[model samples]
Target: MSSKILTCSVLSALATAFLLDWYHKKFEVTTPPTKNTPRKPRKYDDSLIREQLSRNYSFLGEEGLGKIRNTFVVVVGCGGVGSNCIISLIRSGISHIRIVDFDQVSLSSLNRHAVAQLEDVGTPKVECLKKHILRIAPWVTVETHNELFDINNAQPLLMDGNPDYIVDCIDNIDTKVDLLSFCCERNLKVVSSMGAACKSDPTRINVGDISCTEEDSLARSVRRRLKKRGVLKKIPVVFSSEKPAPGKASLLPLPDEEYEKGKVGELSALQNFRVRILPVLGTMPAMFGLALATYILCDIADYPMEPIVGKSRTKVDGIIQSLAGQQSRLGNTEQRIPIPNNDIIYIVEEIFRGKSPISNYSTRLTLSQWDPAKKLSLQNIVVMTKEEQKLHEQRVLKGGEKLESVYPPEVIQLVEKRFAEEKFYSQFR
Candidate 1:
């Protein structure tokens, strides 16, 4: 009787298990899907994208909007500045972009990142940006690179898209220099963001050539490094002109336990990366990023923007003083310079674009008469390095030689092109 009972109990348990399994399969197959079921991806809608960008189209017009749609942009660094920049770019009708970043999102990033959330922590930043981009601009073609942008991998990362503009938001000094040096060497149009950390005043933000950037330590470091690499050409950059208040902010010290370890550098995310964190106000970087986007859009759309030229009035006077001294030594008694004192900055920055057309050198530059016979005027003044000016004095001005005889055809052509552009631009003035 006991044996019979045990066998019956085992049979009952087996039947229950079998029934449970069968019921699961039956419901899974027969039950209609609920709201929890993953839905198919929404199809791309061209009209929707256009309608969403209607305000941008209204602002930029048909030709500008068309250019924006066709343009490809590359953004290196998916942190504060870069994230905001790419967001603006996408919303403004940038159809294609390649985002390169080697960092994973951290909880700290939520304070400043454009689209990061609590769930995005520990994921690659480029992936986060791309995912967010798809949600708003589904038709946008996004290429992501989850790796460090260094000299070794920069070419492929930067050149693969054949981007019309490269926005450099990299914070690492060495990597920043490497990217800028590469772009400068390749003659690639790029705009870089200087240090926005430790700054809070948004009014001080300025966009100008890297040489003209002041009060930002990161810009100074980058400028110094680029100069070491023989890159003296003008590099457009968005930088803050506000000086950081002393004792207001600084790099956070490492924890005692971490400092006890001999390898502090190893503690960084990557080798040679900064272990200490710079205190960031968060809002400053957004301003920098927005400024970058505005500048790039204006540039792409052929919209005219006369940015505040980077130096102070005193600096402009210094340049004039240098030019005057050069003139005085030449012994030409033209009692007064034909060029207005206020117009010197325009001539140097606008007409010549703040660099010598001959060697592309930016330092020690001053205005010089292109032709001795022509009176000093907007059309006659040209930008040249001090050395080039001395040579011009010896050959063209004093020796009575023609410009074409002394300078190469390429140089003459570039100067002439600048003059022609000035002639057209002057109409607006």
Candidate 2:
């Protein structure tokens, strides 16, 4: 009985101690400040920043490093790519940056977010980035905006600061289009990140114009949308040329249990915000982010790189000359189509992707009219190999055969889609 009474007393004492600690933490304030103490001015260790970036100074030279330190950059979309990019830029000596993102760190984001800790989950991504950035780059100025970047707020967020450069790491198609279009209209220097999802190869990544990027559907869509806005082929981007391994990755399918809840659209962050998530290889996004930072830093230091395009204008001229020859062979004495040289180049690079849609041949490609009855315009032209062009002329142009009769459904569908895109672009012209 004495032992039981001692146990009860000990439990009561422990509970009381726990409550006291909680109370102190929750409500107690520190000792009252002593009066008349002069507060010292806050001092930042600029020497430490220089020591931290000493290697950068050596590599970029003193003048180059100075330029980097003074340049202002705005990064939108603080997700996997954007987070890595922000940290890399800060480490590279960019003293001023504005980070824009409306997302909270989710449990799933732990896989690829550069500086997010488990404790950061449920916090805004921009806030988390700023917190960690100030720890390392205390001398740097970081502006955090925990709101989505859209047309409604683009002017003040992008233009008011006169940022030297803008980095676009957004993943949504519509949002990306809006940002890129705004940059192009305002002549703002910008570099964009293309799709890194489902990509596993680091070597396949390349820095190039949006029109030169291949094997990335996201880049293709962005390029097409930009073209519709009369902004063609100058916006730089980092994209993967590697084709996704077959059956290795895809959009995750919703389970039956999820469907039972009804209206899957409600599950998205916003309307048309991509309900399905693409499976990502975490390292790929990091590589893309680093590439973007490297590209921007070099540019800021006055050492810009000429990113490679898929086909040069000289190559386009050859294709155009070859098409003129084909028109001659078809008894059209004019030898020139109704389309302008610039429009023809756009057709070859942007629409046909610098290859034959029928045989996927990149070499010896020439354009032929899909339908002889239609006037030769952007919508009427199609790319084909030399042999394929000859056969098309014999079978369709002169033989009066329908496109459905000569081409398979897939080819027909592809040609139709290209024509529709050309028609859409015509409105902008």
Candidate 3:
């Protein structure tokens, strides 16, 4: 009886101790402020929150914009076209961009390029443009590559980012071809801008399926090369239909040293009526950039726009004709000129026979001529022909049905040899 009573007494004492410790913690947590202490109220910055909310809500109506914010675009030039494109893309809410360009900001670029400020003259274009993008959209993620796009590095650069779209604003034909071919082979959607120089009219620009002609100077060269490799049919391009202006003869030719050292004022004074830079030339790049952005947005919204076909002139005609002849050509094959091969002798003979004439050339070139230095190869020989000289074009387009092959084995061997020789020279340089 005494033992049981002692156990009960110990249990009571332990329970009381535990309750006292719990009570002390509870008192500390609920303690009221002393009379001398001052209380601080929670604060909210309404203006800052309102600003952020406004930006986010602006896109609430645009499902396309929301989709675009998640996509990545790789632009391969940072000059006039590229800078404008990047800036526009950022402003449109594209948060991811990879820019590649090896050029430095030049004084001449300040006239039209978006990011070419006076202070950025010597800075690399990629770096300067990236800084500008960050300033415009702090949330944007931009990667800069200060290098030329080439076969050796293009694949890795493209694959590294896994870009959803590629914009080609590059001027070099070889580089453009390399990138286009790479993109096509990888099945990546891409858009390209052809020569914007010497073009004045912005309305002439159009994007579309690459025509089947070997007549556009740049397009012809690209088509011929791609044809040889069976890649021509797969590539799509955007190009201008306006012809470049004719060359002018200068009476008082400046010396090379003087030409190189001329200031902006001096250069302006020497400009002849035949040679001038149009403000529209700069605007065309921006126009192309917008087209690229539109393509991206359309793709994300599941409303793909139809590719433009041929040059704008022919394309417009086709549209009108299609509306009229909609039923007659229901299953007809799309009309396209045949790709040409390098064979100067055959081309000349065909032209002399009146089977092919130079009139088939695109509007981009008013005059095309063979350069002995540049056209040593038969393939290049075809490229050097005048706009109206069509011996080669006739055989490829009309006589293709009758002719066995415009590019026989011998012609192919000659072209390969010339290309190898050119490559060898390039390696040493």
Candidate 4:
């Protein structure tokens, strides 16, 4: 009726709008959903650091407790092997701790401070180990620096908590060789603690790699001062191969009004060679601080750990080549300087003691010999033989021990030609 039914209903409404746009582009339609889209939240944490490290879930599960809750340990000595290696690294779940030390809590550090007490003697061992690690991981983050870690604040307290391991337990061997050369020049990750003072076996404790330490004489003087500071890498410690024993407790030398009522500093002969009366047996620094928190939580739970076993096969260059062919009966050189001038035989017996023409005997035979081109010169008329001035006034009353030094003119020209003989100045002049 209208141009053939309106061109056949406009070709059936343009083939029903091209079959509904090809059935909505080949079937796919439900669209209503978009209000900040997100649906992935399978996380839960009933933290007590996961219920007291929930028995480290059959050996560190949950990806080793999520890498021990993002690792960061620092512990440079809090005392007694860094307070039992920070109490087995905060009860073995360490969730970021720092704890450097200035030291306090003394009354002789309660035998081997494991978070010491006696009302925490004088406190500040990083505030009693950060209040005993917040009474055991109060969602741990301990930190505390409390000064005295040396080398100008040890590289900003070891990269301001950038640590992933650094339990050195600092007992000052030049601040543990400047914090092991500042963590081997930024390669970081450290572990050190040699010489747990006059050790008491614990089966000769040991770990390794300060060049494979042996017979631990403080790891052979910290491996000869880290090989004179070039720092031959390999550092990793926890040493003790017996050999310290033998101390019968003798720090004697008191009486200055009983050593000023229990000494308060002023004993320096390098602090009496580091205050030794040496008996220490608080279970060998709590078993070398729980074997250095079991080598920092078993190398952060990758766990295979087994290197240190009965150390001391003894080859520190075969004990320094058995102390190099043993020759040192006081004769290395300097024309035979074996140290025995006795004030140039008491100034050549007061220029030949009592009587005999001498007038300082040619400046005392040019002060007994060894002028290896120049240096040993003794001749201020030093003659003392009334029992050598009564044994030098009882060795300056037993304290001023500086038994005079500089002597090397062929060891005082053999005690000045065996006491300037002419029948020994005619029998003591």
lDDT of each: 0.83, 0.84, 0.57, 0.61
Tens-digit per-residue lDDT, 74-132, candidate 3: 88988777788788877766777888887799887786688678899998898788667
TM-score of structure candidate 3:
0.52
> How many clashes in each structure?
0, 0, 5, 4
| Candidate 3: clashing pairs of residues | 208-308, 351-391, 358-388, 358-389, 358-390
Per-residue alpha-carbon lDDT of model 2 for 31-140, expressed as tens digits? 42232121121246778778999999999999999999999899999999999999999999998898899899999989999999999999989878877886677677
Local lDDT at 371 for model 4: 24
Candidate 4 lDDT tens digits, 193-233: 88777666576577878776555666677678877888788
**Which runs of model 1 end up more than 4 angstroms from their true locations?**
1-43, 255-257, 310-429
Candidate 1 clashing pairs, residues 3+ apart or interchain? none
**lDDT tens digits, residues 167-265, model 1?**
999999999999999999998989999998888877778989988876678888889988888899999999876544334676688888987878888
1 versus 3: better lDDT goes to: 1
Ranking by TM-score: 2, 1, 3, 4
Candidates in order: C-alpha RMSD to true structure:
18.7, 11.4, 23.2, 24.9
Top-scoring candidate (lDDT):
2
Ranking by lDDT: 2, 1, 4, 3
The 10-residue segment with the lowest total lDDT in model 3: 35-44
For candidate 3, the lDDT comes to: 0.57
